[model samples]
Target chain A: MSTATIALLGQPNSGKSTLFNALTGLKQHVGNWPGKTVEKKEGSFARNGVTYDVADLPGSYSMSANSDEEVITRDFITSGKADVVCILADSSQLERSLFMLADYAGIDAPCFLVLNMEDVAKDQGKTVDVALLEKKLGIPVMMFSATDTKAYDQFYFTLERALKEKSHINVSELEKEYEKIIGYNEIKEQIKGGNISGYTPMWLTVKYLENDKVVSAKLKESLPADAASKIESIGLDANGAIATGECKFKWIDELLEGAVNKTKTGVKLGKLDRIYTHRFWGKPAVVLTVILGLLGSFIPALPIMAVASIFDVLKNVIGDALVSVGCPAFVTGLVCDVVIQSFSYIVKMLGFVFGVTLVFGMLEEVGVMARISYVFDNTMGKLGLQGKSVMPFLVSFGCTMGGAAGARVIDNWGQKVLTIALAWAVPCGAAWAIIPMLSTVFFGAGAPLIIVVLLLVMILHMWITAKIFGRTLVKTEDRCGMIMELPPYHKPKWGALFRYVFGRTKDTFFRVVKVVLIVCLIFYILSYGSGVNDTSILYKVGTAIEPVTKIFGLPWQLFIAFVASSVGKEGAVGVISALYAGGSYGEGFMAAMSGAARAANLNELLLANVSRPEALAFIFAITFNLPCVVALAATYQEIHSVKWTAKIAIYYTVGALILACLAYHVGLMIW
Target chain B: MKKLLELLKDGNSRTPEELARELETTRDDVLRQMDFLEHAGVIRKVPFMNESNGCSTCASCSGCEGGCAAECKGCVPQNAKMNMGTMWEVV
Candidate 1:
């Protein structure tokens, strides 16, 4: 419980968290960092025999104020108890770093700026004289390498000294001048009091000034009852307010003089920005990657299967050990059912994150994501989409959670809605897990074929919804604006890479394990309490559902478990395992299915039953139907509309039905 | 290990846990060096591993346990039938 408070602040992707972690080690706690899900990381560090508490605020370019980070940073500094505020800046991108620093000039805190990743700057032949910077900002500015202990130690001492002094060094008059643009006191209180609603007024003001369509809805919300007449009277569209905001940025530019300096334009800082965010390239790139993903699936699935098998072996062995230890049936299930299952799910998630994130991230980091926008950028024009709105759509491919997270990058509201709407179509991790489970258990060699069809249908359905949602429900705002940044493409550093896959997989698996253990215990109680004769009804239920399952050549028990799939993929797997002998999950439905399909020459039969192309389509239809339940709830949260959640659920359900029919009857005739 | 370090320094993908496991050591020991390497423009680090899974020799974070690091090569999809060649252009 150190009394000293230290704040680490920076713009998005500025390595602020890295510095915080370097300083704090495991002595950290995470919160919304002042009500922002934007991740507030605080840690305790003892240096010079004095322990200091450090708060790492969310990244923001400036407090001249658009995002919530500006509010958090403002609150932390204005609290008046903080000993020091460490502003970590990316040395490679000083202009951007300075942009934020320039905004912070209004805060009167003893600022010690750390120009981080100096190694990269030097490697690129960029140099900054810290003495020169220290003179420029009138603060103690240290060029640092967090990787090196000596430099890190020097930084620690700076924090130690700042804690000792506990002084508040105010900003210059130059910064006060920009306060009119970045300062937001009214919103700060509202946020702190938990009463702030929909983009703070100041945040809206800046966005409106920039003519950002994202907040056009909010702007309309802000208008008087006769807003339409006011707009008509002003002869201004949605951008009238935002246009005024961007105008002030130029005024603030004058205040930025002397405080900020550009060095050699930092070797094409804005280069490679356009080609990817290409009004045309952005969306097309998305399609191409998807096609590539489908193409890659043929080869990759085997390795994925191999990795999974390793877990199966471990689980079987562990289960036997638990049984031998005389562990109760519940305890045995707790270890094998919960722990092993959770671990397996975590492993699968890691595989997806790195496997998909790497490929997709490489494209994105290299500006390929922007290129993807090109193919579909104009698609927004048809439905009225805007900048940053494309983010959710682009993110939808990775997973819905990613799409939800990607929504953060959307600077405006129209894009947020568009991205979110499309995100519903993106099968989340749970859905991804279920399709594989169903396919492998049933289809065998045809598993990949089924998986591919489901994904395409999701995308097509998403596009239709985006188009419809834009035309009828939400007004579309399609502005061809691009954000450009040129970063030297390098290999991914494994140490720093945060694998969302692992987190998600871990989450999914835990959900599975916890619920499974609970369910087992509950069933254990029912079985013992109700007596074995009556308790056996659960098994009977697994058997009774078979006649309907026979249509798809699946076990009745699978359909029973699948009923639970709506809860989560893991829930389904857990239930399915419980139904089997020794409660084994056994082989997946896809593998079993493909073997059955091959023996009966079902592909040809399906072609004859429906149509040639419809045979493969039939398998895909069942696979794509309503993603497991976790995704449904997530979609509900992101859209924030129960009606729309149902709409998305129904859309997938219908999609699954249509495809399944097409695959079954058409395959009988065609193949 | 040196090649991996060089790869990381070159701003290539380098997982510290993988490298540490290969080096037969703890992740904590390698943590400082990885950061140092990153700071020195010797590597780039992505937050892909959770501590719980990163060192799990089982099919945990070290997903490619008991296998060649090269197995990760199959991660992305490609159109080139030349499966013999590298999928990622190893810079």
Candidate 2:
């Protein structure tokens, strides 16, 4: 009995490991390659009294020296250690998987092809003519599933035959394909018959054209200096690896021209995708979908919002009871105004949070969100950024600070700064919570219209902001096209979607409660002066600023809340709960004393007190305000430019106020 | 493959379907060429997040505040924008 060393080679995920394990089960040893961390596997199997030693080469994309694994695989092949190389390619995608075989063509080694995953190819309506492929390649070709146990009989027969008659892949067709490249023949002639042990001149020339560092170094060392310099000039004109890669792919296509046949299936977009991906209709389709999605969220939110009103009724009952018991006014206000009012608002905010998270999460889970990005990718380009910049903007819908962090993917600093700058205009999660809740309060059944208007305004604001900032931050020359692989739409996993929504809503509940309670407490203190006309310091300051605040259509109280929103959007709600409900403290006290009806619910109180125009203005103001101080810090961290961060903050502030003024005037005209 | 690179030189992003349509080929062909192009260093995949540095930078970062260091659910991953798809750009 003699020993035959057989090496198995393939690209990553070509079922190489499955075949190796099938042949060497329980007899294999795994260790790292010499001086490298890449795993090496060696095993033996005795068949027909001949013991075969098998080396499983590390899987890589190609035989190029692009990585440690590729170098090791090529070195082992060229070292003449293997009697025959069994190259594997995925039959289901021979156009791609055969790339390894194509790259291996010019080597002076005995090899045969194994087209694995034949069952998968058959299921896909493909058939590979093995006899034709074998004749074309001058090698033994087998198409079989490595997972099939009985397939090893044919594999053994092929291996024995491959060993008995040493065969090299027919390179006549491949060399013809390479001859078309501008520099291939010139470089091949310069290095012809050069004293390289394993690589033919054709192989060395292709590697030199590819700028493969190791091969280039070796070739330069072997060839005379004059010949090497001449070869270098010719290789410089080639497109390096891309040109050679084209050659390999083209050659593979030709090799499979007759040997591989498949039923043609043209790519077709789904019905909904047809509308979503339409060039002219895509943006409007996406915009309409988002608007409808926002409206759809309110259905779930309405119930939770109604339940939150219970907290309002509880506020009144607790206050009346505390007052009846002769509780101190300070304790009464703390319990009824700060604590109850803040809890009510936080509960209401959670409803919107849950609704938005569910709607958006479902959209993501079902795959519409990707279409949204596809729709906006061109718009991103117009904004002086790449298509990838749309990702951070989409993230901004959940959190502006996160959007800033997502900007890390953009390699160009100017585009990154501009992306973060534009992302700020998109209202974040907190804004989404507060704005829609406020819209429902002010607009009633027409709240969805307010959301639509806001979305439109948001688009306009981002466009103008990009124009204002893009001049200095991003240059047109820095832009480039991108290739997007849109994922196919599929049924969403309901379990995961609800888990995320419940998780996000629960998170918002805690975060909102903390901010709202703190802001409410502070405002309650500032406005707690014991006077008939509500003449506390906050009252005084608010009245004094009333005229200036009216320009933005915000009352003094709402103006102060707008100011607090810069701290966090949730803080704005706290201010509203304190100021308005604290006014209830005085008004409710007067009503209780006179035996008139106690002040109505907080909703009615707000409706009677703040004009519809003022409410609209306040909503726009807070929605478009600087997201929060944390977001401000995140912006600076991402752009690393205090000057630019401050610039963006100021821009959003002024932009919000302008948008508010416009919305207020529009509201006044409507009413 | 070179034609695909030529199409991208216009600085306008396109989907694989669009590229296939423009190149007058099947989507699989376009994808296979893209794989080759990407490996050859002609194009690169655009990552949406730098997982290593994203959370490490901000200590009080609200996005990662609630022990979601491994995956920030609050601030990022708000939706399926990540599921939107894979993107590659010319290098």
Candidate 3:
């Protein structure tokens, strides 16, 4: 019986292995190729009277000498070890899988094309004309499904025909495509009919242009020195590979134009995407989305805020019960005024936290936040930073520390520093929680207006901070454009979204409770006194600074809260809970209070004692203050420069007070 | 391909869909070109803030530095979707 060897070639996942395994069965043996770790498989079978040996080549993306598998596969084909090569491509995704065949067309081998996975292609509403493809390539072509055992007869017949006819893919169309490349003709002409074996001049020229090291080395040894230099001169341009690659893809499209039938849907942005991507409207669209998202957050928060009011009722009931039971004055005050009051405020703040998390989490899940990031990416250049710097700034809205940590993505040291510097101007998660609560308390129906104004001020603050720091921390040369692949909008996974929102709310609750309780207790103790004449240390210190604090429109008690906000924004609420309601910070202030005024809720007491202008000033001060000491530490850790870190920290501190001064005067003018 | 590179030269970020629209091509075609460009070192992916090379699991760790080593949910929300989108830049 006569024996013939057939080598199998295809890209990975092209069903090459399935066909190999089906043909070889248990007769196949696998071992590493000599000197390389790539697996080599060989097997034999008999059909009719002829013995057929199959060499299953290692699956690779292309026959480029980029890896051991590709090198070994191409080398075996050209080494004349096989009488025929069976190249496989997945019919379902021929656009991509046919790339291996496109790359292999110029190789000097007798090969037949196998459009495998015919069933999958049909299922996807695709019809591939095998005869049309064969006529175009001038090779034996077969539509195959290796998994269908009954199709073995057709496969055997095709194998027999391929071996007998010794067919090869026609290269006229492929060469025409390559000719469109700038250096292809020059290099092909230079290397025409060279002494190099197993490759045509056209193939060698293409590989040389692609900077294939192995092919270039082989040609350098085979060609005369002058011819090699001539080829090198034509290949010197670095863009040859890009041009050639584009040509190959275009050729692939041409080959499949009628051979494969399917709907060709070009990229079309959805209506919302069109608006969001527009140069003039993209920023506004993103900003509107965020503003709407913030407004939506208030809906979920209203119920939680109503629930928080129950805590206020509980505090009063518990306080009166303790007083009626003759509980000690200090114990009654601690339970009713410090701990209970702090919990009440904490619960109120948590309403906004939960609302913000759920709303923003849904936006992220639905893919709007990415567009927001993309819209802002170009603005990074105007801020004297890289496009990636926008990421940390967005993150800063959640947590300035995270934003600072996120700045590590920027490669330039100065841009990283500058990014963190501007990131600090973004009011963080805790500020988000407290700001809304404070706004609602002071402004009533006008709270949303306060939020809008605050957001506008935040934008101005970041812009100014970037300008101040950009000169020293970023270079104009460091900025560049980015290419974004926006994720498609999809329905949010409610289960996952709720899990995250509740988890974050729970985490914030625990952390806030601990800080607020401790801070409130400490402030309550320092302010506690027996009578109107009694002066605690906090009171004395607060009174001493009252005049200085008034420059920023803050009274002593509110000034102390503003100072405490630098520790943590949540801590400001704790200080307010103690100073305003616990009635120990100011001397004559609470003593002259009416019975109804003295018994009023903390909100009423705060609204009475702190004027609207002072409330506006305090809110601005806390919102723009250094996010927290932890954030400052995180900034230092990211930038690794204490000088820059201190500069940023001091800048924010002074900037916050200035903003407060401006907002206070603005509030006075409005009221 | 050269046209694609030229479009990015303005230093304004664009989505693959936008590029496809401008180039009169399909998204798949644009992506294939991007793949080639990326592999050829003509372009690179732009890593965003939360995609920083730091620990993504850490929610609150005070001791770690700013890279992935100190990843916290505080910086990156627990609900932050990883598939916000892919971004690239010319090298």
- By DockQ, the best candidate is 2
Evaluation by DockQ, superior candidate among 1 and 3: 3
Taking all chains together, each candidate's TM-score versus the true structure is 0.45, 0.96, 0.87
Candidate 3 per-residue lDDT, tens place, A360-449, comes to 888888989888888888787788777777777777877888888777767789988888888887888899899999999999878877
Candidate 2 residue pairs in clash (backbone atoms < 3 Å): none
lDDT of 1 by residue, A435-517 (tens): 55445545656766666667667667766777766665555322432211123345444332335334434455555457655
Candidate 1 has a TM-score of 0.45
Q: List interface RMSDs for the candidates, in order.
A: 17.9, 2.3, 2.9
Ranking by TM-score: 2, 3, 1
Instruction: Please write out the lDDT profile of model 2 over residues A1-671, one tens digit for every residue.
Output: 98999999999999999999999999999999999999999999999999999999999898899899999999999999999999999999999899999999989899999999989999999999999999999999999899999998999999999998898999898899889888788888889947898788888888888889999899889998888888877736447777778788888888899998899868889999899889899999998899889988988899999999899889778888887888776787788778987888888888999998899888987889988988888888888889988878887888887888888788899999999999998899999889988888878988888888888888898899889889988887788889988888888888877877888888788889889999999998888776443668888888899999999999898999999999999999999988886743346544542212544666777887789999999999998999999889988988899999999999889988988898889989988
Task: Estimate how well candidate 3 is docked, as a DockQ score.
Answer: 0.51
Two-way lDDT contest, 2 vs 3, winner: 2
C-alpha lDDT of all candidate models, in order: 0.49, 0.85, 0.82
- Candidate DockQ scores, in order: 0.02, 0.59, 0.51
True-contact fraction for model 1? Answer: 0.00
Worst 10 residues of 2 chain A by lDDT: A589-598
